[model samples]
Target: MARHNPSAPPESVISIIAPGMQIVGDCQTEGTLRVEGSVEGSIFAGKAVVVGEAGRVIGDITTQDAVISGRVAGNLVIGSRLELQSTSVVEGEVHARRIQVEEGTLLNGSVHIGETDGSTLTHEGQSDSEEQQLPIDAGSWHRPVVAAPKR
Candidate 1:
């Protein structure tokens, strides 16, 4: 569903994936995309992307801003900001200029924050995943989350 009502402005376009719906292919739009169901492919949005509590995504997402409160099983490259609500579960690389994460959010991969260019997070100068360490620069944080050794 598209928010193209008569009163809605032309530039304020919004696409909605209502509940019980499923999209199997990539979705590209210059406006906003509010997902309330499931998506099996990548989503590219110029403005913003919102995933509701029951929403789920199985592929990468590249957007200006994203608010995820459900499950995302792929990488996220957000240009401006990213917010993960308490119910969020993300399982891939996350790159964003800014991030807000709640207490119960489950993140199971690398996280890169305060990086304007989200493309250079290749663990530069690091060869082993087990030995990956967070940079000393506190303002810009990049760390790969790994399981701790058994006690």
Candidate 2:
């Protein structure tokens, strides 16, 4: 029998949860993990996570990158990128550095994207991220002419 050491990391690793399977506990991995069935617990991945169209997750997810085409009922915290396909249905908050959503995807909660590293762009000595009040010049806009109605 070969000995396995948990202290060292593998160069490349990929884990998969197949269809018709049910997992009821938290899962953590240092590499990519794919889910094709149902999970009732949280998931943590150092690399990426891919959820199939038939998959379902009922717990939170933390990962670097994720591609979801399934149903999620908890929060998602993605460090890099996140993609939601047309078949995906999400009902919880989502936080990701970057995100892509398909036209038919259904998201029922708040979504936060982009970096939040305290580096905000500034314009006119004000933070561009904040709302701006533009001064309206009366002569700058012209109203369209309408035809008069005949009595």
Alpha-carbon RMSD of each model: 9.6, 15.5
Off by over 4 Å in 2: 1-11, 117-151
Report clash pairs, candidate 1.
none
User: Which stretch of 10 consecutive residues in model 2 shows the poorest summed lDDT?
Assistant: 121-130
The backbone clash count of each candidate, in order, is 0, 0
TM-score of each: 0.75, 0.71
lDDT of each: 0.74, 0.71
Candidate 2 lDDT over residue span 1-64, tens digit each: 1123566464147778889989998877777778998887778877888999988887777787
Q: How much does candidate 2 score in TM-score?
A: 0.71
lDDT of 1 by residue, 34-143 (tens): 99999987788778889999998877777878999988877787878999999887777777889999988878777878764324322121112223332222221234
Model 1: lDDT of residue 129? 28
